[model samples]
Target chain A: MLEAFVFATILFGFFGIILKKNLMMKIIAMDVMSTGVIAYYVLVASRGGFFTPIFSGETVAYADPVPQAVILTAIVIGFSIQALMLVGVMKLSRDNPTLETSEIEKNNTP
Target chain B: MNQITIVWIALPLFLGFSGYLLPKLDRYFVLGMALLSIAYGLQRYVAADTLTLELIDSFGVTLVVDSLSSLFILANAIVTAAVVIYSWQTGKSAFFYTQAIILHGSVNAAFICADFMSLYVALEVIGIAAFLLIAYPRSDRSIWVGLRYLFVSNTAMLFYLIGAVLVYQANHSFAYAGLSQAPMDAIVLIFLGLLTKSGVFVSGMWLPLTHSEAETPVSALLSGVVVKASIFPLARLALMTDDLGLILAVFSIGSAFLGVSYAIFETDSKRMLALSTISQIGFVLAVPAASGFYALTHGLAKAALFLIAGNLPSRNLRELRQTPIALPLWILLVLASLSVAGFPLLAGFGAKTLTLAGMAPWQEAVMNVATVGTAIVFAKFIFLPFSAQPEAKEGKKYTVGFWIAVLILVGGLVAANGIYMDAYTVDSLLKALIKIGIGWLIYFLIVQRFILKLPRGMEQFDQLIGVMSLMLVLLFGMMLT
Candidate 1:
């Protein structure tokens, strides 16, 4: 049930991305969606009354270790892409001081 | 270490580092790495054996040098090499240079990986590479489009992860060999997320805008070369689930029709090429949906077509409206386009034949519709080079080596068909002509009527493509239920 919450928040934020005209809002929405997804993985990783993972020598009540591992890689890749997007945003700001999300080189805007 | 396993992952890492260190050396390093891998991959491809090696603990990923992976891996290697030749002087930053090599490597990695978890990681690598490169042009729209892809792909990746956890629960194993029949619901959910990544449909709305807004060569790589990487998982899912055959058959056919509708209306030759790509991908997916040979054959031809389109548009074709031979290169590209349209002897013919052969009688209609769809879209594409007159007075002579490479590829494909299939008599040629005739008739009736000359007209087409995709998504939702 809580998984639905995280997904809803993510989709709501994406609507901000699609609806809002601000670039920062879009980036924030992107971050929001990423966090929602990460949370979903963590939650899903923990199933049943006691989520136990079998490990060598010592067994621990670990959530699905697979989601954790996968989410870790997703986080790293996400950070790099976020960095790339920020670089692009910085370039756009430099080229055109006002960064409207939908602007595509319209001369009349300025 | 088996040569296939080691070479697939390590060579790119080695090439990437060297390419990163030396700006002048990156393209060649990437080109060399792809060529080397193709040579190594071909051996396993011919052996028809599943090759493997562990890079770590029992937890380590296995490289499955089977027919499926080898076909995609070798095709990518060929595409990347041709890109190096075509982009001989593209002095983009060292960042993109290294990224391109890693991208190709990541793609080859995904194709060869045997374990579900390894395939997932490799897919993540490819997805990140896609995100970075899509906006690497550093333009305003490129950034926006890249973000669109970022949001959609990451979210899809989450669904894929959840799907993975479920699969683990159901099957109790991750090896391709261990992929016993997963529950239909689990398989369907996993593919739902993955379809977005692969740009098939439902999740494929990002295809045209992102691929089109990026720089030409990168666009080519994204549409032509990069899309194949994601097919690995989708194909695996299809192999796992019983219902996936029908799912693949239906959705790919929808993608084929939808992709063409957009392409026929697009004005920018580059973006039109991009739309044509989605439809071409539909063909590739359809082949594998039915059988293996189609997947292998279509992957190779489409990769070549994408790479060729990436280079040909370095100059907007608007200048050659009248001079028929203004760009003689178009003649060969037309041949490439012909091959993509499933004209007989070209590579697509063999693949399409197998795809159609595998289908039951009922499914042939779907295949035919896709063919006419491909024809309708590419008609816009084939006529584009000739639409502009010979007004390009720059008189820049194309490099001798460039034409040599193109001619060699064209000749090699026809000859390789004979070698690969062992008998390419006049029968193939006649078949190809018939296919071309069907495509040509569709163009005359439907596509030619709505012609747009400048990029502005394409904006309307993009919007229309957007609307059409949304409608299909709604329809697909009902169907999937």
Candidate 2:
């Protein structure tokens, strides 16, 4: 059930990206999609138990922490990409004064 | 020797960062490091053994250097040096040098990294550097194009990350060597992402616009080496699985024909060259053999061509007639074009002959058709620059880089077709000559007499997204059946 929900969120992100004409909406969609991926990884990492992965005599059923660690790196990478994309959008808008898909497409043709 | 792994990655980054700190010495720093990187890469090539540098085993990030990786890094290092040399004459600011250096380091890192996480990080670094570099000139169109490239690239990376997760879920490991038991679905997912990055047809439709719109030096590197970095990993993955080769071969033929066909109708010089890159990369991706030779030769030729195109007054082919250029520059451009056209005795011919010897008859036929098409398109590019004007002086750096690339092409031709200096059989030479003749005839007869109009829909940004998604589905279906 949780997998289905995460998949749905990812799909929602894709739809938002593809369907929206606004550049800001597209960036938001990207963040949503990345978040969905992170959530899935976190869920996978916690499958064994809710306990932290740190070694301790008291906690025997610790979930896998590797996924959590990897996902953290992924999150940082995703955030930077998003930041760069936003900066690009800002610069693009400053030049054309409009963020409409049609305007951007028309401007793209050389 | 083991330290060579870290040095190849670190030296460039250090030099690039230091260049920022000392802006006056930026160009010299970048150029010196580029030469140093090449020398180190060559040293590794001479040794030619796999060196693994374990950074953090728990994180599964390690750098591995094999002969294949060594060759790739060497080629990348050489072309990057040329790019740095070319950039010197332009009087580009410190930021350009910094970005170019970062790009060089990341590309080298991508070639040598042994695990998925490091590979992922390398790709992202490349993405960031490439995006900023593409938008460096900051024209409205360049920025939009760069944004499109960034978005597509990010989406592709996400798909790749998800694939990595799937593999990890199944096998509990993230190392490339540990993917033997990985599910077919996982493999397919990974390849789908790679397809997007490889600049294949449908998936990588945004490639031409992005490549053509970037600054001249950046375009040269983009066309020459950056795209190949993505494909190197795909090639490595294909070695581990049988299904990827067959699938790759089919897509390769499609991209080859499609790219050349688009080049035929394209009016802009850089865009035409960009399209041809797609076509040639199709050949690179077609077979499972070490495509490093072809990639290296193509990088040299394409970089020189893009730089030549940069010198032209305008990008239109017709403009070449009015503009005056040096005789030696013209000669260099001609050799580069012939190399791209797969003319006999050139590096392109050597790679084509070797790759063709291994393919099935029908696939060979399709590739031949693509070659003829390549000849037709490049004939226009080469003949356009010919003028009777006196020699005009070009920058020393530009000329030097061009000659180096031309020499490398010749050297590679010798290396690729070793023994028997005239390696092309009389029959094969005759066949190649006939193909070029026929292509030229068709170009004048049909292309000029009755123009072939292809819709520019594929070049549009949204349409490319639609095609990429559709092609992913088609690829999945192909894998199933």
Candidate 3:
């Protein structure tokens, strides 16, 4: 079920970037994509395993933990991209007082 | 030294942070400090070892250096030095952002890294830093360009992360060394998605849009070194498969030819520099595809070309002989341009000579054509300086440094002959001389003349061709594989 959500989020993010006219929506789409990929990573590895990775003390199915560790790095990457997008958005607004990609194109051409 | 690892992460971090800490330090100082840091880092990393990096592991990252890392470290440091100097030339008085400096340093930290997770962090930091540098001059257009770069690059990064995740799922480990232990072919194929992050155009669309639009010096870094940093990992992956190198070979020629073609037609100097970069990268890619040594040779030569390409002034070639570039600058420009053309006794010539000798089966003549195609394009550039008033900033403040840098680059190539020469028995001075002669012939006959649209058959790089590459890739990618 969570895999389904992750796939759906990827679509939402993909379309958000390709189809959205507003820069804000595009940034949000990027965020969605990042979240979806991370979700998929966790779901794929951590899913249903009867035997826990916990071999030390208990027979706990601790599940794979490497994906979780890797995800922390991905999360940081996502944040850096977000901060950059915001900076881009702020700069865009300062230049044209608008956040519309369409408007910027028109401004440049006209 | 093992201690050098933190300096890679810290120097830019320090310069970047200090800019914030001491807001009034002239931007030149920040830039100078960054240049000094990269030079020192490069000097030390010339012999840097691949060791267990504990400090990076706190963030679940492991920084290490091997031949691949050192090559990237050397290339990045060289370009960073050039970019910092150029940055100072233009914006020494303006309030340059500290973020840009941090971004540059952190990205270098990423390049020196050994693990996927840590590499991702560095990629993201570089992405943000790149975005801000592009948009810092502050116009609506700059912002949109920054967004476009951010969106495309980060999306590719996520794709790479997913590819990494899939590999991890199969292998249960995250370091590159560990990822190699996985046996799944499907997951290995997914690794191309990581190459996409490096920007190749089929799977990579960010190449044309992002790097082409960044500020001049920033564009130099983004094109000259950033794309290359990602390439080392891809090369590492290719080392795993015997056929993978051969498959990527076809794409390399196409990339080089197309990049040069676009550069020929391009008007803006920065955009032209960017196209030249893409073209040169085609050669860089071709090296690993042909042989690993080609990649190393291409890296050092191309990095030098791109770093200084920005500083050399240009005008259209048609009017060039009628007017003259500054004699000294013009001569320097010729030497640089010839180096790109693979003229004998220079860095590029040596690599081209080796590569020509290495081409398999019947592609030798075609490769020769491509070499001249590069010459044809550079002829356009070399003449540009003389066409109109040379725009090279007057009084050449760092003229000594420029000459020193050029000499070091030239000297490195001459020294490499002893190291790389013995591998290919057929490669010789005679072949090198022929390549130079052909390169010069093209410069004299066609490129130096009035713009006459040639019949499609005499085609040089990207022109008369690209409308066909999509179809070609469909067949080429499958056929080569």
* A99: Cα error in model 1, Å: 4.1
As for candidate 1, its clashing pairs are A45-A64, B320-B388, B320-B389, B321-B388, B321-B389, B322-B388, B322-B389, B323-B390, B344-B432
Error of 2 at B154 (Å): 0.3
Q: Give the top-scoring candidate (lDDT).
A: 2
Candidate 1 per-residue C-alpha lDDT over B364-446 given as tens digits, one digit per residue, 9 for 90 to 100: 77667667667666665477545335555464555554555456456645644542453244765565567667878977776
The 0-to-1 C-alpha lDDT of every candidate, in the order given, reads 0.64, 0.78, 0.59
Candidate 3 at residue B280, lDDT? 67
TM-score of 2: 0.93
> Per-residue error at B332 for model 2, in Å?
1.0
Q: After superposing candidate 3, which stretches have Cα over 4 Å from the reference?
A: A1-5, A48-59, A94-103, B6-11, B23-62, B89-101, B178-192, B201-205, B289-323, B355-359, B362-366, B384-427, B439-481
lDDT of 3: 0.59
**Judged by lDDT relative to the true structure, which candidate is superior, 1 or 3?**
1
DockQ, per model, reads: 0.33, 0.68, 0.43
Worst lDDT run of 10 residues, candidate 1 chain A, spans A101-110
lDDT of 3 by residue, A1-110 (tens): 77788879976886677677777777888788888988887786576563546578756667666677668767876886687678667766766675676676556421
Instruction: For candidate 1, report its TM-score.
Output: 0.84
Tens-place lDDT per residue, model 3, B285-314, is 655533334444454455455545544443
The Cα RMSD across the true interface for model 1 is 5.5
Q: For candidate 3, list the clashing residue pairs, or say none.
A: A52-A60, A52-A61, A52-A62, A53-A62, B315-B384, B320-B387
Comparison by TM-score, 2 against 3, better one: 2
Best by TM-score: 2
